[model samples]
Target: MSTSAQGPTSDESLTPVRWGVLGASNFALTVSLPGMKRGPLTQLAALASRDIGKARDAARSLGIPKAYGSYDELLDDPEIDAVYNPLPNHLHVTWTARAARAGKHVLCEKPIALSAKDAEALVDVQRETGKLIAEAFMIRNHPQWQQARDWVRGGQIGDLVSVQAAFSYFNRDATNIRNKKEVGGGALYDIGCYAVNTSRFLFGREPVRAIALVERDPEFGTDRVTSGLVDYGGAHLTFTCSTQAVAYQRVNALGTRGRLEIEIPFNAPADRPCKVFLDDGSTLNCSSARVTSFPTVDQYHLQSEAFSRAIRTGSPVENSIEVAVDNMRVIDALFRSVESGRWERL
Candidate 1:
């Protein structure tokens, strides 16, 4: 893998991270691959799909250099510096470990692993191999989220008090991977994660407890909708996520002085500016806002850049393994709260 255009850095010896796609999933084609393509510090070296024809098609469509029939073949490629694992949720741990063991950096799709234990084990492997590993939570790297964080931290919204957020999408395709219970399919894993991660990210703190009321489908054994409250220090957050509802993503935060609200909170494109609601009943809208946005502005690229930068700079990121594990810990407790009919202390 030849190096792509490098960013302006003091360390000239550090090469651009040559990137490879591990699956031909919709997200890979529609979101992450495009994000990866836009970054200067990364190169789209290859792509792997179970079907050779599909891989070839994706390679042609995306202008990727190489296409492979098997993931291992892509992993084995000397030119490939990193692999993006957009495989099914259950397959995340296996491929991530395999890629790490093969001496390649990994960027796996979220809920990083099925459990905190698996996430920890994967982190252990990355530590041993001295390779980078990250979960594909695009919001973490988006400019809008960065701005939201700044507003809260800078007292644009004084002394944050409460939060209300929701993300929902109606997809009734039983054949879809998200509807398959055997493969980590559910509203929680598919979209509720946005609500969970968003609340955590925006608040910049850990939840003390979680209370949930889940409306489940008997045939699918998956919750159709989940509404819950998460306590963060002195703050309280209320959220809902669903797979059987009209698509929507919204975040409303109330502070002692004022409140902030966003309509397209997560998965927005990078170049687009996110609208800001300030006190004094005035609106701050950004021309950067684009209808075509989908969470994170070149966020995967930023994510990839951050991982490589950490590799080069030898520092820890906020989205470290321990952080991923903590995210899962909250998830676990939330599910338990749903089942136990009471608030689950986190």
Candidate 2:
């Protein structure tokens, strides 16, 4: 596919950044697409899929005005200012590179690549293209995570001690993409990424070492369950994630003087208030813990707006490719630990 640059428009400052969806993934349809439509600085311009019929149907159903039979066609559309890539893990790097070279900013799905080396390649592409490219980490855009980070940094949690988190869901469908080995399928690449990313985000530092244990499904050749520990020198993080278990998630940060607990940490509710519980360690009773509730907000919308504003104003994107590379390094170390049955230094 030939790459082309998008020309500047006279109304660029006044018009919203037109966005195209690279695929009709469920998450794209249910979350990102709706969020882009609601974003103040973004417009849902087009939808694309390998199948023209599917793209047209999705576009009509979602109220988007245009549809393309292939991702390359969508990338070539000069009217589109950016693209949201909800493609599978393996395709993230390739399509993002294509979109960047085509002069389109990219907001790609999480675990931007299967390995740190692969993530670094995307970082190089971002630098060479000089385009706004970021990993779609919506939690960082949520007020709840920002508040939690503030509390931790402001000494409300005192000297950081440890972080514990768990994310799980039951999905035994062998035919699902998540169950396929060649496409970067596994609990670690899927929901486990949140746990890893959150640990780094809250700690504000990379881990020095990591150890992990993973259990693979014999038929699927993908990890069904995984547990890992990351040693961050002064503090450590422990987390467990499973794809074949009941749906649930929670994150807790413990310090010498206090503790912070996040309910529904990873998959936060957009329609209702989400809460963070804090215990100052001064009290011996559970009732002394302070509860803070955040108003209902769509994090995906916030993410889209932030990206669009960055593209328009030349501001910094929140989840940059560099940060994604760091997260992937930890994930790579964890996988190495799993294979060697020993601690892997990052």
lDDT of all predictions, in order shown?
0.77, 0.88
Collision count of model 1 = 11
> Roughly what TM-score does model 2 have, to 2 decimal places?
0.94
Q: Give per-residue lDDT, candidate 2, residue 238.
A: 95
lDDT of 1: 0.77
Query: All predictions: root-mean-square deviation over Cα?
Result: 5.9, 7.1
Task: Please identify model 1 stretches exceeding 4 Å from their true place.
Answer: 1-14, 270-272, 280-296, 315-318
TM-score of each: 0.88, 0.94
What lDDT, from 0 to 1, does candidate 2 have?
Answer: 0.88
| Residue-level error in angstroms, candidate 1, position 133 | 1.1
Top TM-score model: 2
Instruction: Give lDDT: candidate 1, residue 345.
Output: 89
Error of 1 at 211 (Å): 1.8
